[model samples]
Target: MIRLALIGIGTGHPDHLTLAAIKAMNAADLILLPRKGDAKSDLLDLRRTICAEILTGPTHVAEFDMPERAATLPYLDAVDAWHDAIAAIWMREIGRHLPDGGSVALLVWGDPSLYDSSLRIAARLGSVAIHVVPGITSIQALTAAHGICLNELARPVLITTGRQLRERGWPDEADSVVVMLDGGCAFQGLAADGMSIWWGAYLAMPQQVLIRGPLATAGPEIMARRAELRQAHGWIMDTYLLRRERAAISRDAPTS
Candidate 1:
C-alpha cells in the first residue's frame, strides 16, 4: 500500500504553494514529475525548480514520460484509454523507484478538486491511500490578477471546460462562466454583446498575460495575444471568465 500525496503546485509559481503543500513535499519519500516532451519542457523544468527549492529532505525525484491521448477515438473512450496508459506509466515509475511501497507525491497544477485529473489517475492505483494538499487554483490566480470577483451577488458561477461552453453556448443556470482547458478560444463561438470577459494566460507565471474588458472589444485582443503567446511558448494554458451584463448590476452581492 502506497501513501499517495497529490500536491497542488499552484500554477508553476514557487510562491503560490501553500504551507500544507510545502509540508507534504518535505514529507514524501518520492516525487514523480511527468515530462510532456520538447514542447512542454518548460513545465518539466518548473516542476524541477519546485522540488529543488522545497524538497529539503532526502526525497527521491523520478521523472516519467507522459503518454499522449488518442485523437481518432471518441472523447470519452479516448480519455479512458489515455487515463489507463497514464496509470500504467505511473505504476511502472513507482515500482522501479520504490519497490518497497512508501509515500509518493505527484505535483499537480492548481487544486486537484478543480479541472485536474491527478485524483482520477490515482484512483486507478487500487489499495492506495490518497491525500490531497490544496493550493491556489488558476481561477483564484486569474481573479486576483484582474482584481475582479468571480460571481455576482445571488448569482451562481459555473466553472466548466471549453468544450461545454462551445456545445451549450451560455448556460442559463449561471450568470458568470469561468472556462478552463479552452485551447481553441471557445468564447469566440458565442455572441460577444452584453458580455464582459477577463482572460489570463499562464496565470501567476513569469510570462503571464492578462486582458479584461467587454468581450466585443477585447475578444480579438485576447485571441491575438493568445496566438502570439502560444507561438512563442510552443504551448499555453489559459482560463477566462465571462459574465452577462445583468450580473454586474450588484457587484458587491453577498456570496454566502
Candidate 2:
C-alpha cells in the first residue's frame, strides 16, 4: 500500500510550515514539487528552500513541470481534463521513483481542507492511505496580519470565491464574507455604504501589503494597489473580508 501525505505548507513562507509538516517531510521516501514556469519561479524557489531547510533525511526530492490547463474548453471540462493530466503525471513520477510503492509527501499551500486541490488530485491515486497535516490558512494569515477578528460576536462568516461574488453580488444574511481566488477586486462593486473591508496580498511574506477601512473609502485604493502589485510581481494572490455595518443591514432590509 502506498502512503500519501498531503502536508499543508502555508503560502510560501518558511515559518508557515508546521512541525508536523517538517516531520512528514523527513519521513517521506519521495517528495514532489511542481514548477509552474518562470513567471512563477519564486514559487518553485520557495519549495526548494523549504526542502533544503527541512529535509534532514535522505529523501529524494523530484521536480516536475506543471501541466497547463486547456483554456479553449469550457471551464469545468477544462478543469477536469487538466486534473486528469496532473494525476497521470503524478503517477508516472511516483512509479519512476518508487517501483515497489513507498511513502510520498507533497507540499500543499494553506490547509488542504480550504481551497487547495492537492487532496482532490490525490483521490485519483485510489486505495492509497492519505494523511493531512493542517497548516495556517490564508484567512488566518490575513486576519492575523491585519490584527482583527474574522467575525464579529454571534455572526456567521461566509467564505467564497471572486467569481461567486462577481456573479451573485453579495449573499443575503452574510454578516461577513471572505473572498479568495479573486483575480479582480470584486468587492469594489459591493454596496459599500456601510461596510468595512480588510484586504491583504502576499500575506506573511516580506512584500506583503494590507489595506483596511470603510469600504467606500478603501475599495478604490485596494483595486489600485492590487493592480500595481500584480504588474510588479507578474502574479498575485489576494483575499479580502467585507463586513456589513449594523445600520446598513437595517437600512437594506425590506419593510412589510
Candidate 3:
C-alpha cells in the first residue's frame, strides 16, 4: 500500500514545521517537491532548505515542474482540470521513484484542511493511505503578526476569497472576514466606513510586511505596498482580516 503524507510546513518557515512533520519527512521513502518555475523559484528553494536542515534519513528527493492552470477556462473548470493534471504528475513520479509502493511525502503550505487543495489532490490517488500533519495557517500568522484576536468580542469570523468578496460583497451577518488568494485588492471596492483591516504579506517570513487601521485609511496603503512587494518578489502570498464595527455589547449582558 502507498502511504502518502501531506505535511503542512506553515508559511515556508523552517521553524514552523511541527515535530510530526519532521518525523514524517524522515520516515518517507521519497519526497516530491514541485518547482513553480523561475518566477516563484524561491518557494521551491525553501522546501529544499527545509529538507536539507531536517532530513537525517536516506529519503530520496525528487523535483518536478508544476502544471499551470489554464486561464481561458472558467475558474471552477480550470481549477478542476489543473488538479487532475497535478494528480497525474504525482502518480507518474511515485511510480518512477517507488515502483513497489512505499511512503511518499509532499510538503504543503499551511494546513491542508484550510483553503489549500493538497488534500483534494491527494484524494485522486485511489487506495493510497493518507496522513495529515497540521501546521499554522496564514490566518493565524496574520492575527499573530498584528497582535489581534481573530474574532471580535463574542462575534463570529468568516473566511472567504477575493473572488467571492468581489462578486458577493461582504457576507450577510458576518462582521469579521478573512481574505486569502486575493491577487487583486478587492477591499478597495468596499465602502470603507466603520471597517478596520489588518493586512499582512509574506507572513512569518523575513520579508513580512504588515499594515492596519480603519479601512478608509489603510486600504490605499495596503494596495500600494502589495504592488511594490509583488514587483520586488515576483510573487506574493498575502492574507488579511476585515472587521465591520458592530453595536457595542454591554459588559453585563450575558456572562454565559
TM-score per model over all chains: 0.95, 0.97, 0.95
Clashes of 1: 0
Candidate 1 residue lDDT tens string, 1-256: 7899999889989999999999999999999999999999999999999999997889999898999999999999999999999998988888898899999999999999998888898889898899999989999999999998889898899999999999988776677999999988999998776789999999988999999999988999999999999899999999999998774433433477
210-249, model 3: which lDDT tens digit per residue? Answer: 9999999899999999999999999999999998876422
What tens-digit string does per-residue lDDT give for candidate 2 at 1-256?
7899999999779899988999999999999999998878878888999999999889999999999999899988998889899988999998999889999998988899998888888899888899999998999999999999999998899999999999999888787999999987888777888899999998887889999999988999998998899889888888989999878888888899
What TM-score would candidate 2 get against the native?
A: 0.97
Minimal lDDT window, size 10, model 1: 246-255
Q: Residue 215 in candidate 1 has what lDDT?
A: 96
Score each candidate by Cα lDDT.
Answer: 0.91, 0.90, 0.92
Q: Rank the candidates by lDDT, best first.
A: 3, 1, 2
Better of 1 and 2 by lDDT: 1
Which ranges in model 1 have alpha carbons more than 4 Å from their true place?
247-256
| Between candidates 1 and 3, the lDDT winner | 3
RMSD of each: 4.1, 1.1, 4.0
